[model samples]
Target: MKNRVEILAPAGSYEVFLAVMNAGADAVYLAGNMFGARAYAGNLNNEELIKAIEYCKFHNKKMYLTVNTLLKNNEINNELYDYLLPLYNSGLDGVIVQDYGVMKFIHESFPDMEIHASTQMTITDSGYADFLRKYNVTRIVPARELGLEEIRDIHDRTGMEIECFVHGALCYCYSGLCLMSSFIGGRSGNRGRCAQTCRLDFNYNGRESKILSLKDLCTLDILPEIIEAGVFSLKIEGRMKSAEYAAGVTSIYRKYVDMYLNKGKETYKVDKKDRNRLLMLFDRGGQTDGYYMRHNGREMIADNTKISKDLGEKKQYEEYIHRTFVEANPKIKINGIVTIKKNNPVTMSLSFGNIAITIDGPTCETALNRAVSREDVDKQLRKMGQTMFELDTLDIRMEDNIFIPLKSLNELRRTAVDRLTDAYLEASKRNNSHRFLPCAAHKESRNKGISVHVLTYEQADEAVKHNIQRMVIDTEVMSGDEISRCVELCRKNNVKSYIGLPRVDRGTYNVKSNSDGYMIRNMSQKTKCDKEVIADYCIYAFNNYAVSALEDYGITGITYPLELNEKELSEMDIDNGELVVYGRIPLMITANCIDKTSGNCHKGSTLFSMLRDRKNALLPVLTCCKFCYNIIYNSVPVYLFDKLDRIRIQPEYYGIIFTTENATEVADVFKCFNNRTKPEDNTFTRGHFTRGVE
Candidate 1:
């Protein structure tokens, strides 16, 4: 028989874990107390996670832990091993990971543990999936924005197990590429402390609305298509939700998946009541089919109006779900035979599936008052209350006059159940002797130079006139001929020109070969391009191990992550790193176009849009028509020219990114940085240089 696809549910707590498993989830993914994406969720502790592992082993299900957040240098060095060692020994089935440093650490420390690439890795293509094979990543959760064809192509090329999100909330920006929360409030989404800024209201082109909130994904109608697209696991996205939501959603999906497997797609159908139950469980505006069919459209966005659920309907559904799945305690069935005879030790043999155990009790006594009957012994042994096991069948063989004490029978039953549980736990234990090898130390560099990244030729022209050593031209906005012109301009000024690839590579633009190096943002570009490569900050080199991992792929230059404070940066050995001293940091790289959603799309023309928050701050939105993606810039640039003395790490280059600046503004920034003087205006933010993400 062919292996069926897995229904992967989310469990924020132990109760939710049991509820989803009872609701028919093949596997459940959850997080421990740290390094999880949902920091606000009531996560399990180490002991509880071990108990979960044992429970999964007993039930023949699977559990994957979520270590899917980026780790800092100190966290990786001090806390990572201690945090995972217990889970590793308890036979954790797998781990969903986002950071390269965490991947490397788990691979080395827990060799037997399976590593799954999280959606935060933003793996949109097969090349990146193939690149991760070196770290022994057995499965990958691809970016949710990929279409069915793209998902199938990735599976066809890499042959790795693909996990896709079938239902739940969706992020407006590409996962792991969002820095809005971190830049705005110092709550870094990359660190699992997202402020949900996307769900808030914003004004687009003078029309005040929730422009960034996307409708939740619901793909029940296309379940067969998703399975046929080569997905091995269907993932549901809710760890912060209640147990009722977990059980309700998981049970419905389980019902449909089984129906499709048993009765083919032609006979498969969804009941209207089931659909309504899902919405009533937790409604976020309406639901869309997600990016499976179309690239993106206005229909995919939620309406501007608020959606209020009926309190009566919600309460009724919650009670039904709680009683049906949560309060209901499922037990393991056990068949047993009790042997009782006169003047012989009483014993009971219990069998649970293939596992069996026998327990001995006190010696049987002669019948002084009344002999113990089969019915009496059966009644006493059947009291398997508050235990994971249920007595399904029982046989008793008693002598003509045998009297067994009630206390002895109770002890025997308890011992048999305890032994069975112990046997399962012992069977689930794993041993690993692999030692962790730390990355080699990097030499500190004292050389300080300036590099400027430009979006337009005028910015590049003005940038090269200064003492800048390098210029990075964004290929998403500039045409091939325009890039060549910028390269020629840089060449004339004796500046090294580099091509900056798009933040999201949808296989549209080709790598320009005439540049000094390529500035890559994603792993697919990092693996496909054959040139001097500089890893962008979006690649997330938060620790030395991540930097070493990038270097292992032959990447020499990497940009410093913007979320790290100055003290954190100073602690790292940033010899080959480039620190962005000045720039309007791109807060979000979204697949949904702001112009198209607002009914003002300029077709294939690039235009600048504005998004005003409630605080009346205007965020620049760049619509890149070539790649069909949007780049949302911060309200103000990150200026650190005055704080250069406070930054102790002397990276190879001090980089500046010019996004919405004109020719004169670009020249003024370059001159101020060169003179080591602060800008005249106080509008610029210091970014995370003072207070880093928690």
Candidate 2:
């Protein structure tokens, strides 16, 4: 029979791992004690992780480890190899990875291990998926913002396995692209320490609400459609939740999946009780269908006023789950045979599925006291206590009046079971002897001058008046004609002109431009333009390995990561890097439009709005209708005029980005950086230049 869609579940602890597996999860994705996106989850240690791997292999299920966070240079270089070596040797099924550097290291050191691209990689297009193909990325968990049609297109085009979240809490900002938590409180989502800043209340046009909070996603009703869209694995998202929640949710989804596979979609239907049970487990007010059916909508936001399940119902459900899946430990069934003769040594054989093993014991003597009966041999062999295996059938073959000590029979049974277990574990073990080499340091080069990224023509005109190296015109904000005029203006002033691509490309934006190069945010945008591509900070060249990886793609220059402090940056080789010295850092690039959610969407028009935090700080929100996304900028722009003296490593280019600033403001900020003077106002932030993320 053909295989059904795999049901993937999350397990924060070893107990939860067993619960989900027993509840019918085909595979479980979990984290070790380090480098996981859910840093606060009760992650397993190295020893427990090895045991989890063995359990999965014995049960014929799969296990995937979550190495799905950006790794710092020291962590990836010094610590990662020793951290992953044991699990890799013990036959870890796969690794869900975010960092390009980590993927490269794992692929080289453990060549047989499969790599699943984490959703934190922000993969949205097939072009990017195709790019990762060379790195041995066998599967991709695309950004949750992608629609079903978009998902199908990716699967059909690249033929890469697609894993998607069918049920979970949703993030307002796209995964891997969020800096709100990091910028706000130094708890970076990229580093697996998100503080859930989006769930906080923000005032939008005098209305105080959790505007950025998204409802939990529950796609039980649309399972058939998702499977038909070529999703190879259906993932449930709640590693931070309880074991009961993991098992309960897995059981329900497993029921429906089996229903759909056994009896066609015509008979696949979720009962009301099961849906209510999911809600009783946990929810953010209520749930939404997510971006599967439609893009973004106001309905997708959590309604905090909605009624929640009572304590009694929740307690009852948890009890049921514990009794059903947690307490009940599923055991492997094996057939056994015991042979006892007068002169020959006593022997026992055990068989499970395709594997069979036999053990030899002490010789059987003549009748001394009482002859060993078939019942005696069967009783001793059936005593498989505390072992994973349970005897389904036991056959006793012996000569009449054969005397065998019960102690010898017990030893024979124990030996047979031990050999079977060793065989099972040995089958899963791998022999990867490859060694990892350190990434080579980049050669030092001369520093390039200042470059400006402008979102408006007024800022562009003001930027060209100064002595700058290059100018990047954002195509999402400026028209083709306006961009062309700006390019010509830059050329006339002896400045190289580059076109800035949209943050999220749905394959609608035109890439045709007569310019020096393209400044791309994602990997998919790299293939769209043939010009000298300079990667934006969103591409995340955090470490030397990542820098080397991006450079191997023929990228000309890379932007320094905004989350890193100056000390961290000093450790990295920044010869071909650009440091953003001035600008409002983009906290979030989201698919949900702030304007449309507020009942005022100007079709294909650029608009500005303010999101007032509880402290009365106004964060600038840029609604780019043309690209159909919103960019939430930090309240204060980063001014490093005085701090420039503290930076030890000088990058190739000093970048100045203009987002909400007008021509006059842009000129003032530019003058401060150029003249090496501090701004009079105290509204500027030093950003992550001082305190780096944990």
Candidate 3:
């Protein structure tokens, strides 16, 4: 069972969920309406989600909810937590998280909640996987663009479970990081409602229209190769597909996986019969193996209609029957008067406005009902039965004038089957079942403190009152008296403080081993006595240099963003240092409001349209900070809280960060972290002074 290759499928709805599961999906991945990457699909609503979870557990299958959408500073709200808590508490196996902010919040809410880093994180290296392990992430879904070798390397180096996309659609940009949909359509893909604008044909002057539409990824041929590579799960990427499509895809993959495992990998092939069956279900253009085979991007597009096939001939009577039904009068019925005879034999009296006749016979019952005028009666008779008694008869026997419509009785039978199938299908997936541990609400931490850019006294006072234990003061405003005052105030309020200093002498800011605490800034600006001044204020900082060198200089903590490339961070020996677990990735450096020179409005705010091979994002100036400009594009928020296991960070040296404006949102993030931490552990601790050797 441990070596079993899991066939993961997409469950856009309960029906699709069941079809894929019954059709042979080992697991099903779905999303709630919010924060899911596939926004446009018929994704499960909350009530449906509850049923889906029950259904998965009943089938002994794993269900991974896709919380893998990028978040803005404003979108992280109390309502988000309201939805998250119940799911986590309900013995939900795992959450597929994309953004760091969501990861931070989930980690802070359910510290023990199993998290899988979504491919959206674009983690492409073993180092990245190793780095993510610190957050206790169960799996790392590597970027879709990775080769089989790359996936294996990551698997070998880091023992964390690795999931890879086996089949379905492929993205032109890197998975989980593409901004093309949001940039063009204002429909953010990270939110699960992506407008697939890439498939459209466009023209770039003089050239015949260029079809940027990509071929769907069908890796049936390489099933064994991927499984042999030690991939934990073989995921199919189609959250917004029809039930039939999900069934077809899942069935094909299931058959192939069985073939590869039971038979041999050489036995598997994508032949004409299977291809036709797949295309008959549905397709965008056609299918391809995609980047699973290493190649330049040129072959991404292939022959579009090569997959089409002739549908062959229909039955001779099919057309006539279909046309007759299509054009028939639907609102016609015949009424008859009823009578009964001796020996329990049923008789009918027909009186249609002064025309009366007596029909009495057990065998005559069939003939009498058919004598009433309706051309479509034969069709109804064929479906229901040969005789009136067999037609679910309701005997309204009377000596006088009561009229009963035979068509009306026939209509009842027809409606019953429709309702029965509809009801059964709906009822099939629901479960009021209970588990060993039902999900419950856990209180998240509310630790908000100083990340003030200006580092003013007013902001510092607010922090002191709010039990904000940490302050990171800028080196530009570094004063011994101000630092001492802040340190004493922190002590009085039972808070810890750190003065920020530039990394110069040994890539760290020096703090005295005596009073308060210190943070090391990685910014490349240092004066002659920058380290000297920091030491005078009892400040120590961790930066991009040797940890041993910083240890000698009494550097207390390291300040690094969650945006560190995993390979780059793995090369360093940061045995005991703090890392930024959560924050928005400031991915660009721009001249201040260069595009918004016109004072009237930011009407013509231009962004990076296209840069080299990478697509450009509209870097709108979301906010104006005193020193640095906070520009927001459709840039994804980063969450490393779930990746604590891969990163191997000492809890004391790990921290989650939010800008002053968005600090409150991290309340749930810290709450989840604090609840999971040991009573004596300071890993849930934050701020400049908390990163001391413990």
Give each prediction's root-mean-square deviation over alpha carbons: 1.7, 1.6, 18.5
Q: How accurate is candidate 1 locally (lDDT)?
A: 0.88
User: Per-residue lDDT tens digits of candidate 3, residues 512-572?
Assistant: 4223444533211222223322221111121222233333344444344222244434433
Looking at model 2, residue 395 earns an lDDT score of 80
- Model 3, position 546, has a per-residue lDDT of 23
Off by over 4 Å in 3: 73-75, 269-271, 305-694
Model 2 lDDT tens row, 1-694? 2257899999999999999998999999999999999999999999999989988888889999999988888998889888988898899999999888888888888899999999988888888975687688999999999999999999999999999999989999999999999988789999999999999999998899999999999999999899999999999999999999999999999999998888878877889999889989997889988999998999998999984858899899999999999888878899988788888998888998788898899999899778888888888888888888899988888899888889888888889999998887887788873767877776585755888999988899998888898898997688888999999999899999899999988766778988999999888888889789998999988888888788877788889998888889888865778889999999999999887888877877788889999889899999988888999999998888877766786888888999988888888987788678889887888888888888
- Can you tell me which runs of candidate 1 are displaced by over 4 Å? 1-3, 304-308, 433-437
lDDT of each: 0.88, 0.89, 0.51
**Residue 173 in candidate 2, Cα distance off native in Å:** 0.5
Q: Which is the winner by lDDT between candidate 1 and candidate 2?
A: 2
Q: In terms of lDDT, which candidate is strongest?
A: 2
Ranking by TM-score: 2, 1, 3
lDDT of 2: 0.89
**Clashes per prediction?**
0, 0, 37
For residue 686, model 3's alpha carbon misses the true position, in angstroms, by: 35
- Pairs of residues at least 3 apart in sequence or in different chains that clash in candidate 2: none
